[model samples]
Target: MEFNFGWEMLLLFFAAAALAGFIDSIAGGGGLIGIPVLLLSGLPPINALATNKVQGMAGSFTASMTMIKKGVVDFNKIWFAAFMSFIGATLGTICVHYIDVSVLDILVPIVLIMIGLYFLLVPNIGDVEKKPRMQEKLFNTTVVPGIGFYDGIFGPGTGSFFSLSNIALRGQQIITATGNAKVFNFASNIAAVVVFVVSGKVVWLVGGVMIIGQILGAYLGSLMVIKNGSKLIRPLVVVMCFLMVARYLYGKF
Candidate 1:
């Protein structure tokens, strides 16, 4: 369900997508930027959201690949977790309506606020590795699929959730943690895109335009993260989490 907007409009949205990708590469919540622009471009809400995922997948892929090339992340290590995340998201999509999201809708923002606070309060939290609170196998089996399921069901803050899980449970530094988060985030996005595409809700024309910008921005943002580490990541993650909290809360009140 693609719409025929002018190149001028497409360019405007492309810039927004680029900004989204830049922020998303550091933290998560690119949708906080991309989705609004898509909506403003006159697409229906569902179409805008689906298209945002389309472009977002591009950003995630770009950032993930850049990290892999830079030796910051080893895809081989997290392959199984990525697979589990993908499968969980697919299942979550299939079971979307069967699950009651009312509780989740309320519970999620509160959790996001707490996460935001954690980042703000503990400045040195993710700068270096800490003792793992969860086992690797256990984290892979549980948190990976858990966040992926949440991604499919509610569709926001998946990256921050993944990054936090990696840092807190896997004892990863924030930069590497963010890179690992992108992989699973990409996997979950694939599941989302598949479901959205099958439902014919995506506006590919808009998505295609935004994707170019996403790629460029994600690449640059990933480079900065590589150079600067948590100094760049912490503030952005903080901003994105609170922004995500605001977005979710706005839906309620």
Candidate 2:
């Protein structure tokens, strides 16, 4: 595929990336904004998804770094989980061609809706830490990689899944969950990036500009999460979840 994007289109991508990064850093579903813009810009589906992953990784990396600097993410505890996520993502990417993903097409939106509802209706969820429903070791071993695998296969609400599971099962505060989600999401993204790069689907020029935008947007969003915690993240999570659902429905139907 050949892309000769002019300044106007370049600026448009940068704007979309910045906005997506900001929202993604806070609540996930940045792809809902980013992917459509990529497609609209005339890249084929594979190139768009591939290029979007590049920018997405940059946003996740920036968000993770910001949170890590603020000491919200515990590197020691999440290191193993990140490794598991990487492994899961690699397998999922390789298996994507072989697997039947139609079930996921139906199930994921329902799961995202439930996650959104859980955050919406639950009082004081992720406000203060409670006794964890799942042990940290078990959660890292199972749920972390499970969500990573899902992301590699069909990514849309991966961030929400990470944040929600961290909060609901692991009993972390929203700020903490969001921070950890970035690390896990970044780990999962690495495997996908390698695949895309090998297949020559990525557009480096578009990805380069978008990376700059994502870094800026993710940094600002991370600051907001650090300052406001659940007050900011909760509402965005709900909104992003619904947006992800709509994206999935539109694609499928």
Full-model lDDT for every candidate: 0.89, 0.93
User: Runs in model 2 with CA error above 4 Å?
Assistant: none
* Ten contiguous residues with the weakest lDDT in model 2: 244-253
User: Cα deviation in Å at residue 66, candidate 1?
Assistant: 0.7
Best by TM-score: 2
Model 2 alpha-carbon miss at residue 169, Å? 1.2
lDDT tens digits by residue: candidate 1, 92-196: 887897977778877888888888888889869778888898888998898999899888888788899999889888889899999999999999889999878
User: Residue pairs in steric clash, candidate 1?
Assistant: none
lDDT by residue for model 2 over 1-253, one digit each (tens)?
5799999999999999999999999999999889999999889999999999999999999999999999999888799999999888888888898989989877998999999999999999999887899998999989999999998898889999999999989999889999999999999999999989899999999999999999999999999999999998999899989988987888767
Backbone clashes in model 2? 0
RMSD of each: 1.2, 0.8
Candidate 1 ranges beyond 4 A from true positions = none
